[model samples]
Target: MVAFTNFAIAALAGYAAAHPGEKHDAHKMKRELVARDNAAQLGARSLASCSNSASSQALKARSIKRRANAVKNIRQKRGIKAPARKDKRTLEDLQKWEAVNHNMSGTYNYDMFTSIEEVFSGNTSCILAPEITNGPYYVVGEKMRSNVKEALYCDGIDLFLEVQYIDTNTCEPIPAVAVDIWNCNATGTYSGIATEGNYATGGYNSTYLRGIQLTDGDGVVSFETIFPGHYGGRAVHTHLLSHNNAQVMPNGTISVWNSPVSHIGQLFWPEDLRAEVEATYPYNTNTVALTTNDEDMWSILSADASFDPIPQWVYLGDDISDGLFAWIQIGINGSADYTEDEYYGVAAYLDAEGGHSTGYTIGGGGNGTGNGTTPSGTPSGSLSSALPSSSSA
Candidate 1:
């Protein structure tokens, strides 16, 4: 009842401030997620306590070097002269050079590339509680892989994503945690489910733009993907789910049936970046009306002083078309568990035959006992039986 009320309020608010082509309806209500409902549901060390720690300093230095090297590589590839290196760099100088050479006007501020204080400090302090509904399109037991981009029917600027997980209770990195991420392609359609408005090349059998990766010793996981496109009534975003003690099946999917979900949240990009990217090909071709961050209820509610859900990013080269490198720290309650969450009832889990279906119509609804079959009408055999699971450790 409370969730419905929140949805009602958000829907009303969204209607009052609808954008030029946005339609507020049942589809809009699906995004009414309130992740931050109470204090116990959140945890993260105060910035002042660890902002200057040795670990943080090392992280900041490594991040800076990684971005600088990326920029240098792009320049080298394009036959552009490399900028002179400096022992100490200033934001003003960086911005001037980027503006003159990269045409970064109307895009994200140059400071976001250099002054990544938010990235270094990390916003992982705000853990997403289990009670919050995962996004409407979330599928369990996705393939375990770093490259989520299948390029089947999607095209846009490349996005190399790196995510670091931190335990809120100890303010320390938590390695070996399974992180699941999925998003729509440049045309605003998701894979792994038979949904309306999806591309002909996408459906229950397709796994594009959806995959999982385990964090390394540093609690980091990287992905090669394309920037996500927007849909009606929602801002551009990516959905994420974290699992603790989840095992990998023989067919390379996660064992979500028994694993406890530790966190469920969405990551957002700066509007400036989104606007510039959307102006490009394929993305600009999307017919859905653009939804700004301020107008989206999730974006509005996710904003708080303790954490910044947006990732810190850098352009791969002098132009937005060259692609991007983005990173963020996500905070999670390492001990919390939501194995019985109601949202899991509709998950399209994996079968031994490499099929994913829950007998439900996916984006639509029905009884959960239909014959398991791929979108191509191939019988997937009986439901998946328990299989051996793998671990990062």
Candidate 2:
């Protein structure tokens, strides 16, 4: 018994030495294990076909009209002349566009929508693949609002993102479903988490570039923010989580833990678009190596014959720098029961003051650690209040 106790003590001490300042929480460890299992089983649940129904087409038509009218109003206010219609594009044109390489050395001049007819005739189908993981930085209980930019004068081209949620079971729009999105700034650092790595700067008290919005009657939610910057080893993308029947707490944050996670996926950008955006101002300052769509494994899997995960986007003006308006229809399984702990791949949780470690150790993948500094302040009504009493790091 004495020998065994000594051996155990030595092993515990070695583990402590290996991971400094990281507490081991059974709850968080279990959550991570469950999330991995979900990833292996999630592919079976993904909807393989992105074909649209008549009802879905009608819903998309209304959404297109709404966006067109909004764009028209903006054009009128800017006093910009309408763009001239180009030659009719064939399947060969689409093939060439999708095959655009990142190493090209010329200015890109592709515009998806220049006229109302072109906008109406665009594809409205959306992929329902749950193949992409929620990534490590997905935090629960984000503030409920539309604009996630947090009014910061951040660098990068302005991006207007619109997402429409559709129920795969009924092929109809899903209203009132909550959608959460978060991404890095122009410098490739995410908000609300600090770590011992270079991936994310420690900003636990900050909530920039993160927010949640409920889908409107048309099952649409929009966010006004900057184009996300690229991080090393991963292509430029935005993380998204969907909650169905989740109640917004009095503090204006959703209870992601208790609510069912209807969908967990990442939205991707085209290689050409990413290259163009990264070549411009502050984005060019990010020294991390860019990962093109062809090189990233996840980006490859996100594409198939029946579905394409890339969002349909068009410039808000004559050029890419003028800003962009992008939209994507996401089909989700309404009955797929998943909570934050199951499929979220959560690495950290943001407390009322800043962010707190979940005691889940991020591997050498260098996503980010949960060692965020706790800012001293009076805890206000935020996502922390929505957490259960048992939820503590």
Q: In order, what lDDT does every prediction score?
A: 0.57, 0.57
Q: For every candidate structure, what is the RMSD over all alpha carbons to the true structure, in angstroms?
A: 8.0, 10.1
Ten-residue region with minimum lDDT total, candidate 2:
100-109
Per-residue CA lDDT of candidate 2, range 210-234, in tens? 8888888888898878899876656
Query: Candidate 1: misplaced stretches above 4 Å?
Result: 1-37, 40-42, 45-132, 197-200, 249-253, 343-346, 352-354, 359-365, 368-393
Judged by lDDT against the true structure, how good is candidate 2?
0.57
RMSD (CA, angstroms), candidate 1: 8.0
**TM per model?**
0.71, 0.71
Residue 389 CA displacement from its true place in model 2, Å: 11
Query: Candidate 2: where are CA atoms >4 Å away?
Result: 1-54, 74-97, 100-117, 120-122, 151-153, 199-202, 340-343, 361-393
Q: How does model 1 fare in lDDT?
A: 0.57
Candidate 2 residue 167 C-alpha distance from true site, Å: 0.9
